[model samples]
Target: MRPLDPRLLRYAAGARWFFAAGAVLAALQTVLTIAFAWSLSQAIVGVVEGRSLAELRTEILVFAGTTIARLVVTWASGSVSIRGAARVKSELRSRLYRAIGRLGPAWSAGRSSAGLTVLGTRGLDALDDYFGKYLPQLILTVIATPVIVAVMFWQDVLSGVFVVVTLPLIPVFMVLIGWATQSVQRQQWDTLSELSGNYLDVLGGLSTLKSFGRAERQLTRIRVVTERYRVATMKVLRTTFLSGFALELGASLSVALVAVGVGMRLVAGDIGFGPALFVLLLAPEAFLPLRNVGTNFHAAAEGVTASEDVFAILDEAADAADATATAVHPGGGPSSAATAPAGLEFHDVGVSYDGTTVLSGVSARFAPGRVGVLTGPSGSGKSSLISTLLGTVAHDGVLTLDGSPLPSGPGERPWLAWSGQRPGLISGTVADNVSLGEASVDPDRLTRALALAQLDGWDADRECGVAGSLLSGGQAQRVAVARAFYRALRPETRVLVLDEPSSALDHETERRLAASITELAAGGLVVIVASHRRRLRDIADVELALTPAVAKR
Candidate 1:
């Protein structure tokens, strides 16, 4: 709600230049306004004093020149503001995306992806009105209002006093109206985000809903959310119209007061006609900037709301980064790439969510060239432990590799490979999915990975459709596992983690996957698998059992 947020300058470099340009243009515009008013007043008074048109040609030409200059300046200001808005929007979107990536999947798990999509797209686009209309007028208000009032005071103290006293009334009314507008605008924004999230959820689960004969029920839910958004939008528009009327009325009456005072003084011969006319002309100019600011503020409120949300996310990412930087290492220093670990070890690691401990005081080590299996009942923290190793979940105790402390987060752990329970595949060919994150797909590695995942002779050119819809449940699961295998085949990858890789496979396919995991361990990789399948535990060189704990809701 601020006229300008300091964080906008911090996040978008273009904003700094925009403010600089706006100030220059605003100052130029103010000077031209004063010049045009004085020139026109002098021309009128000279003609009334019996001077010919040719005798007053200088004042007439000056009036026309200032008018043209003002027009050019206005156009230039608009062009600069538009380009600046585009640059700021692009920068904000890019920074927001990078921050989300750094926060990782664990941080995003509890958030709504559809809401975020709306924020990055439609929400930020609202800033067009803010930068183009509201901010320029704000700059003018700061630069033009004071100077015009000073000119008025120089001409006549009574008119200047009237302006100074009544100018504050517009802002007083503006503050009251702005408070109401902000409340309704924020409600509208939230309802829009809700509507987007609900629609996305229905679309994503449409097949399952149809299978249960409950697809029609989702239509009612969507309709309810859409109606809520529509009502919220109408409320915002209502407030905007009412607030605009209030501002216009206040400005008009204030101008009328100045005009009435000037006319009476001119008739009584207490003030010269030229000075009276000049004071009257400058009266509206003094109030114009403030009035425009109040009117455009409502239009820009939504962008202001969206920017606040963006700043919140950016701040959270920064705080997370700071905490990670100050984290204590077991070895008293971070491990270097030259001192890469030969094994993975957990020394009393624990994980918690909302003050409820899910895994506590668990310790284990899986050496290179060995397969380690984690066995536990549901909600016993099998996946939680895997999350700690993946650097997605914060842990209570130290995690070290070959007696050296591991770096925080997956971005720092290029030597690790993992596949979760979900396929997480995009629309692409099988080869593209298998060789993800690589600059170029290596056909040899792609074929070998698919073969190891028991997908031998599968089409590398086959499409997976959206979220791997073209593939069966078993096929999608294998493709996800193959993605891990493809990464594990790299020379630098030292550890491989799989969370329920065989959940969707039959007994024969599970056996083949177990043999593949054993083969990977034999090739000097530390393979860790979290599953309840007895066959997977049978192939492990080390087995860790987790006991379930009561979780507070």
Candidate 2:
């Protein structure tokens, strides 16, 4: 990991302010350090020379005052660094969330949600040690170490040379130790993410495992993963302790070298007692910042690793944005215009994944005031087509609305409302889930949408619990469909797409949903339903059948 990542400054504006404040504090502390060392040295020498107490009074007070000021500066520096870290973490997290949203469901489908949860929460929290300790010491090292060494040089050339030569040794040892620490720290972080992901997976599918009499096997699996994580953590801790000891030893030896030189000069009368004393005092101060930096780096290594993960995500988002901007649309024009026709058209649209075609050369159109049903066998590209329409997947050919190309970014497709195979319901009241994106719930629309989805007379205030656990499977599915219905109620919504809306419902409820879909189409909206039910296909004003594309060898 870099001593400081440039991406942190680029992504978190607050980090810039933190650096500024830290530098100011470090400079002030350095000045006070010099003042304190000088005053104390002079006072001690004056007493040894048999000077009167009154003569040494000013020197005594100067050192005392400088000591107090140094304490205040240290406290203030810590406070500033902590607050700055909070702001930076907050900013980075917010940006990370936005980037994920932009990447959309397609990008996230291949990633572990549990791992991301760990990263956004506990992983980023590790930065507390980074900004609070490591960065402050680093700034001090840059601003104070050289200044102290220069002062030593001015007083005694031999002592200054010793400092300059030995200071490099601490950094050299730090580099070697840091490499090992980073390798171990990264392993620990990965293990933690894997543990979180596996644990979440086991929980999510515990019911299925129990049904198959295999739940006990999962316990063993989790135990093994837990042990692996424990071992990884121990390795990281071992590396940290060993690296800390190495840095302390190097700093101690360097300070001793300077101390021995000063002691010899004083014995030989080659330097004044006051100058020798001052050099002796400043020698440790010169090494203090560098030594602290090495110690704090290990503590902050985890945060550095997390930041690297965050930067990778941010870079992916940036690259995706660039690709979106430069990509060519098949229709060769801007997105749908306000005056365009109220219908959707597919011009030989195709989709591929990992160089294997899933959809190819399919053409179709659905006009307003029509119920269009897509029927196909498994692996027939039905979901792929919907993904392309939702702007979650890239496709060949063109999808147009009212004769204009459809926008390829999800955020730009505000006119489309959809419900997928998964309920994806959050913990909230029924009304809250239905009117999710609305600024405020419209009571009339909420009641109508629920009624249209065969949820009429159901309490709007019914709790969904976690992932709609409070509702039955069919009810949760309806709630998801109702959410899409709620969105379709908006005047701006032109198309409503539902994937397997009736898969969990009984025959009677499926018939009612089909009638409701027909009613929606009557309102001059293009309604598309992807399903295998014969009743739904019979009610459609149009039907499009898709076949799986042949893979090229």
Top of the candidates by TM-score: 2
Query: After TM-score superposition, what is the CA distance of residue 532 in candidate 1 from its true location, in Å?
Result: 1.9
Check candidate 1 and list the clashing pairs. none
Q: What is the lDDT of residue 443 in candidate 1?
A: 84
RMSD of each: 2.7, 1.9
Error of 1 at 448 (Å): 2.1
lDDT of 2 by residue, 407-448 (tens): 775566678999999999999999989998668999999999
Off by over 4 Å in 1: 50-57, 327-341, 550-553
> Alpha-carbon error at 37 in model 2, in Å?
1.0
* lDDT tens digits, residue span 103-212, model 1: 77767887999999999998889999999989999999999999999999999999999999999999999889988987899899999999899989989899999999
TM-scores, all models, native as reference? 0.92, 0.96
Question: Which whole-number lDDT from 0 to 100 does residue 299 have in model 1?
Answer: 87
